[model samples]
Target: MENVEESLELHDKYQFEVKFTYPLDKTVPYTEYNVETFMFIPNNLCVNHTTYTKDDFYSDMQKYIRLKTPTMLLKNILNDDKSPLKALKEAMKTLVSEPNNELKMLDYKYHLKMFCSIFKSALRDETIFAEKLNDKEDAEDYIKSIIDSTEDIVKKFRDLKDIIHVPGLENKCYALYLFADEFVSLSLDKYRYRMIFNLDKAEVKNKKKIRSELIDLLSAEIEYRKSARYNSCPDEKSDNEELIYRESTLKKLMGSVLFLKTQTMREGIYIEQIVMGLAAGLAMAFATAVAFLSQSKLENFTFSLFMIFVIAYIFKDRMKELTRIFFHRKIQKRLYDRKTNIYNSLNQKIGFCKERFAFFKEKDIPELIKKIRNKDYITELDNGYIGEDIIYSKRFIKILSKKCKNLLDDFNVDGINDIIRFNIRNFLGKMDNPTRPLFMPIEGDIKKIKGGRVYHLNMIIKYGMINKQDIYRKFRIILSRNGIKRIKEIPLTI
Candidate 1:
């Protein structure tokens, strides 16, 4: 009786049939049967649903997946009582309401995961998204919106500061202000995220532990800004005048202005001997002219007069030599007075400052300064005498100050050191070796020389050297005390 009941049930199950129809109109049919009935008849089951493919299932699944993912939704929303799955279903319906490629792809969970990963990565390393974000002019407006929002938070914090005694809030507030300041200062070429990151590192990281240090740095920067040291638009009035004067002055002083005395005086002594010889010739010529005129022969008188005239011409050249000597003395005196005035002025300034000029190496001019005093132009009793004067006189100082005050104002001890080095090289070049080139290698090239290869050459010529032309180039007499000491330390040489 149990076998009979099973057979009846099997027959009822085998009575139903199933079929599948593809989009191409091909159809497959099958009869449903129990395991026992399948022995008697060929049994096949065709399983088919709506026309949706695997891709369609994935597309539908993505919308629900994104809505369910923890990172995609806000923390507060994800924590609510509603089931994430149920919420996702509703979200998917809303999301797919619009038809687009993004909407079409939203159904796939992998697609959603990929999208979320890309978004997160972009937020983490904003350089990846910078181009996309900054492609529009409205990017600035978007950034301003974020800044405005942050400002509101700052305002709220400030408002609560009186009521709530937050110990570390002040530092935090300062850090925020620094961040805002840096953000506003950023250029369009710079990535906003980098600026923010730098600001956080520079300001926020040390704000709590090294509050005073951070504040001090900020304070100094603020003070510098207030002083207009880095002003983008400098005071145009000062700049314009400085520019005009620099152009005009440099143009005026373009070429060498020869002071004749130095050249003429050196050549004068030789010319004087020539003048005396010419004077003797003139006396001889006068005697001849008188002798010839007494003869009263017209041709001889004319010839003698011409000869006298030639001798007179030679004498006239000697007058030019004498005139030059007189003028050279006068010019030398004037130049000495000018140099003395400048030295006295500089000495006074240096004395008041109690800082000795590095080049001079003297507190005051010594009483036994015989070399300078021996000059015909300078008197031993002259109170204006400071010492052997520098080539940089009052006019040079004034002109340099006016033209390069901007540079000097920015100068430091290192710049002064460079100036000293430059002046030393210049002074050395001028002293008894003006034509012999000074060959100091550039700093980069200096390192290429082996240690043992380098050597020093120091020579002192007391009376200067005589050249092949028998011309005696005068010894440069204007050495500072330091210069004299430096020269004396070395043995004398030609």
Candidate 2:
């Protein structure tokens, strides 16, 4: 199974996160996902093959895959009977109980790191959700729950720390403990400010109370981090160095547990070399045939023979180039632009992914997609006057599901996340000024206004998986010469 989520990352960048999941009971060890994005650019932008080439697109595009964030709810993680906290506590207890088991020790450390990552992710989601709540009571309730759960979790972690006396694991535990503490404090502080921004004047008392509570919590963590006997930083380091190094180290450790290693290469390199060789051979055969025919017709190095030789050389060069171009196009249709091999930390290859990009003619697009794009327009004449150029980008992903499951057997890791970010600054070069002067008559008086000029970049993303129906999403990106105004996702009924 596959899921795709799209959002605007920055003023000029668009992001898409594709998640691929494998069935637990299925015998097949692999799953494939195919995604195609067709971008329809306005004609006024003058975006075409000459203006925006494949190289230009590749330069502005970035793609990478990482293990999906484990799903652990903030409320459940701390207070539930069968929670991730309980699981990690049990894992660590087992490791401390059986100190001789190397595998258990490694497993315990893995769970600790994973718990830190899961808690941070869950915390971020909960805070964002709480901030977005429309009802004041609902937001207050949610924030209270977050505070309560975090307090419970912190108390439990403190108790759990006393259980870990093993010298080897103590340092790792302390580092992660500090990391989690800092993350919780920072997230709560940010939430406090954002929620305050959304509060009205009448809610000043409630806002002040909320801010005081969050600040108290964060201040306590800061003091604990500073005065703890097992300092996360070395005594020889200065305060600033210790702060920067500690943050960087903790982030690197988190990334080590979450991100996968990948190796990329140009796809079908050998086949392309072979195609070129064959084209050369065909050209050589033509040249030899011409030489033999000319010698048989005119014996000496005369004007006629020289002319034939010159013509043969010209035709031979043209034939070789034309043949190469034709066959390369054929090859591209069957192959991809690049292939990436995914690997785990142990250097075990998990799977491979492929990607391609091209510009498609109107006739080449699918009927369904074309109809969907034109559905909003009332008449066909609209397309004639305001037509769009189409750009197609494709991604094919295949992974050994069993391998991924085995690597993350202890946790509930469902899939891999393929994140793609594309910058659209290249399309802005030919754009007109952001605003134009417009004159209008208002109540029999002449008035002038600055009318905004913008372009519509309509995009349709088609996603498919094996043995499943395809999914489609449409988005319209409004852009001016300055930057992107906004991105709107259009609902799809067909």
Candidate 3:
């Protein structure tokens, strides 16, 4: 009883002496207190008190103690009765050496199923989107749904893999995981989204513009027709007539738009077809070559090899040329039709006058020029109008002079002319008779030519051998009369 009384007295005395320093007439700074002092403060006195109950504190204390204890020591203590730790260690070692093959097989099966399901889902989405593209909003919603579905499937696979454990299963899981990431990455690619968005925007803008222009034009025409009718002979006509006319005009315009769209689609299809055909042709050629090589005897190996290589080369070259010609022809046809359409439209709007005087005449020259006269600038040249006299006339000379002047202003023509002269001399030097000029004389020293340099027409004549003196003489006379006298001199030799 005395000892208990002594302890209580000691505790009271200690509590009385423990005085927290509160700044007088100023707020006490919480940070000044030591951790122990701060912790000792009562709930009411503490600045930011957390009300942790006794049970909560005890649980947290237990957890801290558990974490502080060494793992090995804890294991030993736990297995003191039956040595479960040793057994578990041995089991783990065995598991490492000889993993559960059955589990691995099951994982593989699950993985394959998931892969197939993903592919099926993707195909389904593509089909649905392709079939139901009547509305743009619906199409976008469908795409988003597809992406979401894909992401969900990937997550499912990930979750499935997480619960399973087997040797090499992780590797397979990792591969599948990477594949999922790739699929997601492709779907999320900003560039792909931008491309699709841009295409859709362009299509929308073009459609809007076309519709606006058509409506305005139609309205103007209707107003004009109404005015003309009222002025000429006022009569109450059936409203159906105007409606029918408008409908017909709209239909015609829509038909033209449809035609353009069809042409574009057809061109794309043709390109794809040509590419597939070329690929197939190449595959066939390779297969044939391999079969021929396999069947050939060792004695004729060199000859067969040579023949195969030569044939392959020839085939490849021919195919390249054919493709080039095909594309060139398509481009040419499109350009020709476009030009023709433009000309026809212009002619319709502005009545066709005499061919020579038509302002909107389809000439090779840029349409920027306001007026074109027959003797304007000593040139009346047209790409479509070809004749010997036109080719050799002052008009042609003036056109060439103007073009040459532009070229000279834009580039170092003197340097280019030098390069041309050097190449020509080098080419001529290779011949047997180097001193004797192989073609007609170029009218003057090419190096000394002023703004423009002249190339002899005969040098281009077949094999640099044919020299038509009459042509050269005529050319010279034309040039001299046109005040273009500085021509490169070359001997005429056939």
Candidate 4:
């Protein structure tokens, strides 16, 4: 990460750092990742020559990637009359400018999805997305042809890093069509898209103004969207009422899915209720009752024996199992109801969207943008934030595993599987921070690393170096905070 940071600082010309404000000892979302031990962790940032924290930086990157970068790429595509992105740009404009027309929305969505696919492929192999214009007649065909010509994914993002040219560094001016869709995730997941500038410091008053302006721009955009959405109601309808009515039932249910999934801190399948194993408990209870009552000759003795039996068989042990099972079932039922409702609602919404070529209403796009763009900036870059450069350590570790094919991309640098390595991980830096994996660049990077070094893998296979199967042999990777250092190489015994 430090190397990547240095590369960017010189290439992108911006200072980057990670904050340890949140205790590295505490169990954060990245607990299992052991990521803290190997990679950097950031609580804040100073990029594009401004300042930001986790939340604000994430929001800014999301808008820039989905809107700004894509829009710039469209402009790049327009330079060639036959570029597929031209169709995309036109569709995007139609989607944003027109009212809620499902047809237009579908067109834009389709184009955006294809554009992202091509963009991702380009990142893997560095195939220039803007080349070979006037070759294909249809946009999809053009994109498909590019994809078809490419070899399987090559993880190096040489062309991509050039596109997303650092928007910050205050004084740097980046070229258009340089947006690399996967680089944001590369920086963020590795905890590299961070800085040490505190917006409250008094020395950075000038830089603070720029940061504040961008933050204010984000905030204002959000507030504007809220107002627009609120004011978009037709005659006789209030904004609040209309807004609620506009959201499909599926959206509400899906929103509830988030609530249900995390309601418990348990590892997986949050057994809200246990629904199995009850007949045996009941049988044991009945058998014990009958046996205790069968001895009637000595009333006191029978009662004592019965009490002992009940305590030993039912109350002491079986009852706990019985109670747990019953309660688990109850929770299971509750969760089942909510989950079923979400799925059913989702199906219904999908049906509706399918029935007609539906998309966000035209009025809704700006409002949505306003709402998405607008957000509160917790740490403001005020005039007080002026000072000398602040330096912070950034940890970067490299891992290479063959049988553990998924380790790097599917897992973590610290050897923790991704299931436990929480914290919003994505090549996309994901929009809205749902902590999901929409764009996975880690796996691609792993594929690109050859002979313990990060880069393309052309020589290893076609050039007759190591066999493709030899790449997956097992080995021990000694871990460190300074970075991953080769301790001892253990060849696969098997």
Best model per lDDT: 2
Worst ten in a row by lDDT for model 4: 455-464
lDDT of 2 at 98: 83
Query: Residue by residue across 415-452, what tens digits does model 1's lDDT show?
Result: 11000001222223223321233444696564333221
lDDT by residue (76-164, candidate 2, tens digit) is 78766656678778987887778778888777767777777777777778877876787777777887787787677767766776667
Residue pairs with clashing backbones, model 3: 441-490, 442-488, 442-489, 442-490, 443-488, 444-487, 444-489
Off by over 4 Å in 2: 1-27, 79-109, 127-142, 158-177, 191-253, 298-303, 375-386, 436-451
lDDT of 4 by residue, 24-128 (tens): 111222211011111111112122123323333233221000101111232233244544355555664565555367777555544544444334333333223
Count of clashes, each model: 3, 0, 7, 31
Q: State the C-alpha lDDT per candidate.
A: 0.27, 0.73, 0.29, 0.28
**Weakest ten-residue segment in model 1 by summed lDDT:** 36-45
The TM-score values for the models, in the order shown, are 0.20, 0.80, 0.19, 0.27
Q: Write the per-residue lDDT of candidate 3 for residues 1-494, one digit (tens) a residue.
A: 00000000011211111111111111211111010100111112111113333223222211000000011221222234422223323333443354556554443433343333233334344534434465655544544444444445434433443433445444654454343333323222322344344334542324444334434533443464455332211135644664445434433322221111101011234654676577557656765675566456444557767676677666766765676566655553332111011111112211101100001122432322112111222122311222111110000000112222222131112111000000112112212221232333366633332343221211111100012111221111112112222323233332
Q: Could you tell me which residue pairs clash in candidate 1?
A: 59-107, 62-107, 62-108
lDDT for model 1 comes to 0.27
| Candidate 4 lDDT | 0.28
